[model samples]
Target: MRQSLFVSILHDIQQVNEYFIQTRDATGAPGLSGVQKMTAAFQILQYGMPANAVDEHIRIGESTAIAALNFFTRSIVATYEVVYLRSPNEVDVARLLQEGEQRGFLGMLGSLDCMHWHWDKCPTAQAGAHTGHYHKPTIVLKAVASYDLWIWHAFFGMPGSLNDITVLDRSPLFTELTRGHAHTANYTINNNVYTIGYYLVDGINPVGQRL
Candidate 1:
């Protein structure tokens, strides 16, 4: 993550959770600062480093590092989940539609893609089921991101053994649309009106087996 973004997240997390705030020890010595705790947690999360490994760089013990990570994650979810981790509202849909029209994709919402994250310590019993084209065990993350890099939809935890189509079939990404709870986007292309918004995908069959 960029340093500025990391700093912003750290600042927000600290404001919402007192656990990240630094305090003094009983002997009048200064304890770990918020930066140290957040750094330990961020390193473990971004680099996939073990808790014990963070001590070498951040001077944090394994247990403390683990605690910091847990608290940091919980704080972030509590603080930002509502705004950043939700389906697009009407305003969001309007903005997306306008941007799409400007880009010659009148009814486009975003770009859809799947990513595989290597699972280094997968259990032996489950390893075979998680192995994929990469010849390694991994977990799949299906996401829909807008032009500004804002991920409006994220579905994760599927085994990498599943292909993009299979993963999409199992995801809740279209649940809202299927239930008619999705925001409607109406646009005209070549004088033809389209009511539903679409995501730009790769190597997938067209909807309803038609153009």
Candidate 2:
């Protein structure tokens, strides 16, 4: 994370949780600061390290480190989910259309894709239903991301036994569009005007079908 961004997060988190602050006891021994706890959690999350490994460098017990990770995730969502996680509105759609036109993709809203997140701790009995073409237990995350990497839509937790087609069938990203509630984006291409927008997709995704 950027220095300024990290500082902002730290400041906001402090407001949300006093545990992040450094306090001194009567003997002047300092308790664990919030930064250390949050940093340990970040390392474990970013590097996929075991919870116990953070004890060596962070001096936090394994159970405490786990609690920190849980608290950190919840705090982040409570703090920034409204602004950073919202779907596009009318103004947002207009901006996306402008950006897409500049990039030669007229009426393009975003790029659509699905990724398989490996489930390492999947139970043996559940693995059979979760195993698909990858031959491993996984969960699907279908997303529509803009040029700026803003993920406006994400549908997760689908069983891995399904393919891209099946996943899209279950995804509600296009439900609004199908219901004619999607934002209007009229754009010109090849001297012709069109109203429906499009999203770039990989070959594995269903094509020549209504989106």
Candidate 3:
């Protein structure tokens, strides 16, 4: 993240919740600043560091670091969820279609893929169900990302034991299409007109199939 963007998010989060603000201890000495708290949270998130690991660099205790991370994530979602975590609107669809046309794909929305993240702290009892070809407990995250690097759709928390096809079957990416609430994308390809937009996917996913 850029310095300006991080500062912007920090400022917004500070406004949304006072938990991130700095305060003085009972001895009248200054305590941890907002920067320290936010930095602790960011370091843990960005590097997947343990709570106690931040103590060496940020001077935060394990419990306090964990609390800061929880509060920081909640504050971010509460402040920016409506604007940044939603389905694309009509204008967004139109722009995407135009970009697709310019790129020689008449109605392509983006690329679809799945990634597996190792679950280091997975419970032993449930580890068998989450273990996949990677031979370890993991979680899957399926996403559709456009050319501009914007993620249009995200579905997470699926077991790594499931393949991309199984994950797609359970994903809500096509919920709008099934409910007839999706925007129409009219385009011509080899004299055939396609009304629905399409996402580019690897061979693992069946082509010419729409939900």
| Candidate 3 lDDT | 0.87
Clashes of each: 0, 1, 0
Q: In model 1, where do residues sit more than 4 Å from their true spots?
A: 203-211
Arrange candidates by lDDT, descending. Answer: 1, 3, 2
The positional error of residue 77 in candidate 3, measured at the CA in angstroms, is 1.4
TM-score order of candidates, best first?
1, 3, 2
For residues 1-211, could you state the per-residue lDDT of candidate 2 as single tens digits? Answer: 9878877898898888776778999999998888888898899887778899989888999998998899888888878788777789898999999988898888988888888889888899999999999999998988888887777788999989999989999988878889989888898878998888988888622321123
Q: What are the candidates' C-alpha RMSDs?
A: 4.4, 4.6, 4.3
Residues 1-211, candidate 3: write the lDDT tens digits. 8989988888999999998878899999998888889999999997789999999979999999999999999999899887777788889999989988997889988778888899988899989999999999999988887777677688999999999899999999999899999899999999999999988887632321221
lDDT of 1 by residue, 2-92 (tens): 8899789878998899888889999999999889999998888877899999898789999999999999999989989999988899999
Highest TM-score scorer? 1
lDDT of each: 0.87, 0.84, 0.87
C-alpha RMSD of candidate 3: 4.3
Off by over 4 Å in 2: 1-8, 43-53, 178-180, 188-194, 203-211
